[model samples]
Target: MKNVYITRVSKFLPNKPVANDTMEDRLGEINGKTSKGRRIVLRQNKIKTRYYAIDEEGNITHNNAQLTKEAVEGLCDESFSKHDIELLSCGTGSPDQILPSHAAMVHGFLQNGNVEINSPSGACCSGMNALKYAYMAVKSNQVNNAVCTGSERASSWMQSSIFEDEVQHLKTIEENPILAFNKDFLRWMLSDGAGAFLLENEPKGTTPLKIEWMEGYSYAHEIEACMYAGGDKLENGFLKPWSEYNSDQWSKQSLFAIKQDVKLLGKNILSKGVESLKNALEKHNLNAQDIDYYLPHISSYYFKENLYDEMKDNDIEIPWDNWFMNLSEVGNVGAGSIYLMLEELVNSGQLKKGDKILLSVPESARFSYAIALLTVH
Candidate 1:
């Protein structure tokens, strides 16, 4: 098979930083809890802070198309022209507009009509999905070069009125008002940022990271487990309010909100994720030990901890003693998590030639695992 390579990678984050201490303070004021307990919880996570763009009104910023465009421009500066690009893909949950894809808008800003563009939204696994598509395109000889970008502006989705409405419907409401705050919900784990990468067919003289192979798999289950219904009920900040009922009945609702996706926390997901990886690797005559880096979807901290344990139980020895955890700094960038992490590793000098990286992304009702062997040449 022809090798698909990553020639360049870059990321853009907002100028402001939200420290854990500050977040704790805010949480304390709302929860009316003692500072001491909050401090312990924040410290235990080892997450000092995360970042998000803010508006002039001092509210957390929403996805900024201009920022995404600037970030891509900065990453591709002087390296490749707008004309050389064949395809542009943007994986994101936050779109500036609903009609035109974020990728199409980006391509327009670049003033490049020659290049075809696609915007993919896979909830949290968008970055991996974009790469999977890019690799397929290259392998099939559809394009000589492609650009993939993942970005999110989650704060814009926060609606206090919707949350208030949902809270009123809860069967058991904690006495503490802070418990009622939306930030206390596990969905608040996500932060904001953008990442971009330039990919090309393995050129003769240019050094790039070679891609060996890529594969994907998806599984569907009960819609109640994870559905994107557009209603007033604030379930992880994505679904619409339930048309039938005004609130989420924790006991009566088919699914329970556990601060993390219930499927991810369950053992079934890990087993399925591993099985998907094993099948792909077997086709290539490889094994888990052959992989140098393992990048799973940026789920919550607890989900990560459980996943790590499950991998060990399956006898999958990841290269690093610990998985490359980036959520501490950026929170969960949703679909952009894997792509952003890949760029960070390359920039930080952690990824090198001939390294194999495994990516596992579980989104909504589907799960996907891809293994790409990189050869730096």
Candidate 2:
């Protein structure tokens, strides 16, 4: 087996930044009742602003493919040819189209004739999985170089009118607004962005990040389907297919929606994640003292304290000062969050030769956890 390393990483964020104040006005009463404004949510979550691939009128300005193309293009060198990439590992929370796999679409955009492509779509964890897949390919000598990307166009799925319409329909039952859902919570939280990494079997120019080891775990049964698209959870605990609904019904219910119990997620995520993380570390013989930096893909500010507490309880003590996070700037970008954070840290030029970095990504859907160890030199 050969060693795999990340030669370069790049990111492409939407042009416009949507401030918390702006969304405070845009996201109206939650579930048709006076609710905490977006500012409160933003402040509580420690998020200042986020980028969206949409215009002022809530019209989508870019699709997934465009965002992905920009990210990948930025990572490529001027002399780099499309054929230089031997594998394309693409992942996303929501792709523009289901027919054409996101990886294949990106491959087409790159005009890279036929390289092995894999599209892993498991919400937030997909990005880490894609990178892991690329690492395995290069480590096994299946590919010389691979490009792994995580992209999302969340604005298109965030149709405020759909939630408003749902609120009106539920009014007949006189259901409590709080009991129904605010729907706009995630709409105001998630942002749009794409991040790409070029991985190679051998070192490239300058310092390359050697992939030490990677591990993943899932507690899907412990958590319900929290984040998803193209289907709705029915009262009978089954997913109601989007095809069953009429065109008008589909417009409101078919897109992304969060019906999970946040309290449950918050309660179990940290403990469950720490347990899994500890196992991975023990398996690889890694400990807090060995890590130089901790790059965590946390969803929101709410989880920060929980994560710290869990780590403390589990005897996994990594100082917060040694961690890097971009939640305040990028919001929770689902699968793209970790990649964007890595790009920002790399661009800061703080990491030097022989740095050991620990990367962890935790997904809401199914409570999936992905962790990796990297060595920079």
In order of appearance, the predictions have TM-scores of 0.77, 0.91
Cα-based lDDT at residue 335, candidate 2: 87
Q: Tell me model 2's lDDT, rounded to 2 decimals.
A: 0.79
Candidate 1 wrong stretches, greater than 4 Å: 24-46, 55-64, 159-184, 203-207, 221-224, 227-268, 364-371
User: Which prediction has the highest lDDT against the true structure?
Assistant: 2
lDDT of 2 by residue, 1-377 (tens): 99998988989998777787675334344454555545565666888888888777656677888889889888877767666888889999878887789888888788867789999988888999999999999999988899999888776666555566665655676655442333555766687899999998777856689999999999976566655566776656466667777768764443445444455566777887898889999998888877888998887787788798889888898988888899998888888998999888888888898899999988877688999999986
Per-residue lDDT of model 1, residues 1-377, tens digit only: 45688888778887566786555332223223333334444544445555566643455443546556666775554556666778888877667666777887878777866777787764665666677677778767898878777787654443232234334444355543333222234334555677877777774323477776667676654223342323333545344434455344422332222233344435456667766666777788876777777767645565566666666777765655535658677667776677677777777776665666666666543444444455555
Model 1 alpha-carbon miss at residue 231, Å: 4.2
Judging by TM-score against the true structure, name the best candidate.
2
Candidate RMSDs in order: 5.3, 2.5
Model 2, residue 356: C-alpha shift (Å): 0.8
